[model samples]
Target: MAEMEAALLEIIKNHAVGLTGPLTRETPVSDLGIDSFAVVEIIYEVEEKLHVEVPFNANENPFGEMKSVGDLIDALQKLAKPA
Candidate 1:
């Protein structure tokens, strides 16, 4: 989870423009000021890097349930685990 979180943070930092504050688990995606397109790109990057298929629908409200980085990480962790 820590590794995933680190990778996620790096992806966010790379994609998010003009991010001045330090990103933490509690930090909301809204705070990052990333648009929907960037969110899709981020999701794609996560899937590619982590080698896990996210059960999220990118065409839908991708960030609707994912308010914070922690939320995203939790979802990814659950989905990444073998059934």
Candidate 2:
């Protein structure tokens, strides 16, 4: 895995309390024990640690269509790019 991916995985793993097993790219988002607060925390951590801005709105669920960690990573990657 790339450095960013590894870092992202580590961040996700830290918050994945509901996951009984190992976390991977295929790990489902629903299994990560993520509540609304966790979502904000994760976003903050990502921006602080990765130095990448993740556009988010508390009024909307950006992760509603996301199924796996890979999808989340992909979304982050997209947001990290200079547009």
Candidate 3:
């Protein structure tokens, strides 16, 4: 749990989200106040960090309307593969 939390935080921090402030799994990306461009940018970063290729398709929403850091991590964990 702690590891996943840390990984998620690290991904966000490595990107522009750090300009806002520190955040936890409960922190909503929407609440963080990032725009769509930033969201995609962060997703790219996450994909690299997780070592998984993110699919860009209309039917596939990687984040899946997630509302929390944990939720995002869980979704990413599913996409992140076993590596």
Per-residue lDDT tens digits of candidate 3, residues 1-83?
A: 56755866787656544356567777766666666566577667766676666555535665658886667667666655433
Best by TM-score: 2
Candidate 3 stretches with Cα past 4 Å from truth are: 1-4, 16-21, 56-59
List model 2 lDDT by residue over 3-55, tens digit each.
98999889988988898988998988899988868867887888889877887
Off by over 4 Å in 1: 59-62, 81-83
Model 1, residue 9: distance off in Å is 1.6
Give the TM-score (vs. native) of candidate 2: 0.85
lDDT of 1 by residue, 1-83 (tens): 67877987888778867567998888876788788788778777888887777776756665568888778667666765422
**Candidate 1: how many backbone clashes?**
0
Question: What's the distance in Å from true for residue 22, model 1?
Answer: 0.7
Error of 1 at 31 (Å): 1.4
RMSD of each: 2.6, 2.2, 3.0
